[model samples]
Target: MNAWSGRQAPSLEDFEEMALAALEGLPAPFRDLAREVTCVVADFAEDEVLEEMQMDSPFELMGLFVGIGMAHDGAAPVTGQMPNQVFLYRRPILDYWAENEDTLSDVITHVLIHEIGHHFGFSDDDMEAIEADAETEH
Candidate 1:
């Protein structure tokens, strides 16, 4: 039998698990700050979200960070404010994974860390360094 036989795409729950694992795998300092951020996985970007982002396709967005970042208001908690959240679009991620050289776990980790970077108001370069640190620790 072919090595690919009987294989199937990961389900929503599986994606969630992978996302959480990625969060847990971050370096200590990043992981500590990221612990407060919630991770949510969905099949695709919602219509309203796509409209708001001026995106024509759901696949255009793989993940999003929702809530005030540390750079804004020191990330203080205000009354009635929603907790910080990182949303992972599973279908788009899987689609990207299908076309990329990276493994599914690596893709998921990248997206998760990118969103977490938004939560901490870190730049792309900072996130890249964090990812590199994580890889070295593993």
Candidate 2:
């Protein structure tokens, strides 16, 4: 008998659950700063997004940050501007999880923060520091 006979790959809904849980676990300060940022989970990156980002495959992109970041705003949102968004690519994240030793939650949290880091125009070093700080709180 297969030990995982009834198991199936995590659905988009499952990924959404993970994404929300990851977001909820973030430090209050960081979460507050990203309060307005919307996050969505999809099986793959949209074709246009992949093309724009110059990726050969959707699996190459784990997540994406879209819309104007706070760091770029000289003023508040314009009348018709869309809210900032983070797109988490499920298939790619699953693939990445499969190939790495890290736990699934860690992967999700990393991707979430990395995208948010881009929104805040954080450097790699800054992100690392933030990640380290967040870890200490957990």
lDDT tens string, model 1, 1-138? 998899989999988988888888889999998877899999998899999999989999999999988878575677898998999999999999999999898898899889989988899999999998877776
Per-residue lDDT value at 81 in model 1: 86
Q: How much is the lDDT of residue 77 in candidate 2? A: 76
Separately for all candidates shown, the number of backbone clashes (residues 3 or more apart, or on different chains) is 0, 0
TM-score of each: 0.95, 0.92
Kindly give the stretch of ten consecutive residues in candidate 2 with the minimal lDDT sum: 70-79
Residue lDDT tens for model 2, 3-109: 89988888889889988988878888888888888999998988988898899988999998998887898337767999889999999998999999987888888
- lDDT of the candidates, in the order given: 0.90, 0.86
**Residue pairs of candidate 1 with colliding backbone atoms:** none
Candidate 1 regions off by >4 Å? none
Give the best candidate by lDDT: 1
Score residue 22 of candidate 1 by CA lDDT: 82
